[model samples]
Target: MEANLTPQQLWDCALRLLSRRDHSRRELAQKLRQRQFDPEWIEQALDRLEQQHWLADSRFAAVQVRQHVLKRHGPLRIRAELQRKGVGPAEIAQALAAEDPDWFELARLCYRARFGPDERLDMKERARRMRYLQARGFAPDHIRYALESADE
Candidate 1:
């Protein structure tokens, strides 16, 4: 089933995928391979896309970061997700640093939204809230401030 696609067909499929959303080079390659495209032809298609400036890891990472931030996800989760999508470490660092989101504020907002305004929580309740924020990928310090402070 995979071997029937000509190079043009494979290239067209790649473009269709990119048309829907940005994809890192590795991600695009993986998608093509999954569709049963020939490995050699997939590489050629990727190289062509790269040369034409249609496929870029940096652009993909930037878009992913923006979307994740809008969804209220933390830096740790965004970084891990980008890495999972096969973005390189340097690009990941650059993409994360380029954005200037208030991580502490984000944590607070997420906590409040999830558990509501800070009532006088018992130790177990406080710990539970802390765990929730932590699972959302906030750092410990940010979680502490979110759980302990009354700053809205």
Candidate 2:
């Protein structure tokens, strides 16, 4: 179906979509395409939103990182998710770097919460926990630290 939306209508639709959640430019473009918006109009609308500071990959990455961290997700998982959401590598790097110190701490807390006290995990259990944490995007160093400093 052809989209009969005027530029203003498309802009409004974009804003409403953004209001529900922050979207990367590519994501927004895809959404507009799904809605059958003209490709050129979609690009124009994206540009307008960016000029207005309504759509920013950096901001989206930051908010996504904050949410994932609060949800106890590891950096690897966060980075993967951001990439899936179409955030650029540079923005992802910047966002991840900004959370470097606290990222490990968050992973540690999540590990403890999921696996219980460190002493409770045996070698097999430790390996299992490590795998789980790694899948969640935690680094090996952080996993090792959590295992080593696990409360008995």
Candidate 3:
């Protein structure tokens, strides 16, 4: 891959990436780095983007949370994914609060979507459903709420 692009070219590359999707500043830096861009140039380019509000961690976090919620993922998984993308804790928390997803309701929806609504289950099936919700990143309490509410 050609990695000898000028600073102008590097800026353009960043723009092209942002045009496709919102990217956290760190994520954009990593992407540019993967293409073998100089670390210093990448940082400077990122700074320019951030100064201009073209790249924002908060915006990226918000977008990520919304997208994952639409995909029926739980908060724990969402938090981990955002951290991996280099979002700060404060931004992640603020984004989550801004979205304000009802965890229990979301858990129930995911549970129902996966296992169907309120079918009687043996111990084995019950354990399987719990595991499924757990894997989807719901808190233990949220999973319990989702499952228990089905009984009422």
Per-prediction TM-score: 0.93, 0.89, 0.95
Each model's lDDT: 0.86, 0.84, 0.92
Each candidate's root-mean-square deviation in Å?
A: 1.5, 1.8, 1.5
The clash tally of candidate 2 reads 2
lDDT of 1 by residue, 59-145 (tens): 899899888888888888898899999999998888888886899889888887887766677889778887887777788988888
Predicted candidate 3 versus true structure: per-residue lDDT over 53-106, tens digit per residue: 999999999999999999888999999999999999999999999999999999
lDDT tens digits by residue: candidate 2, 35-131:
8778888998899899999999999999889888888888888989999989999999998787664766777788878877645556787678889
Q: Residue 29: error of model 2 in Å?
A: 1.0
Residue 9 lDDT (model 2): 77
Question: After TM-score superposition, what is the CA distance of residue 119 in candidate 3 from its true location, in Å?
Answer: 2.8
Model 3 scores what on Cα lDDT? 0.92
lDDT of 2 at 72: 88
In terms of lDDT, the best-performing candidate is 3
Model 3 residue 48 CA deviation in Å: 0.6
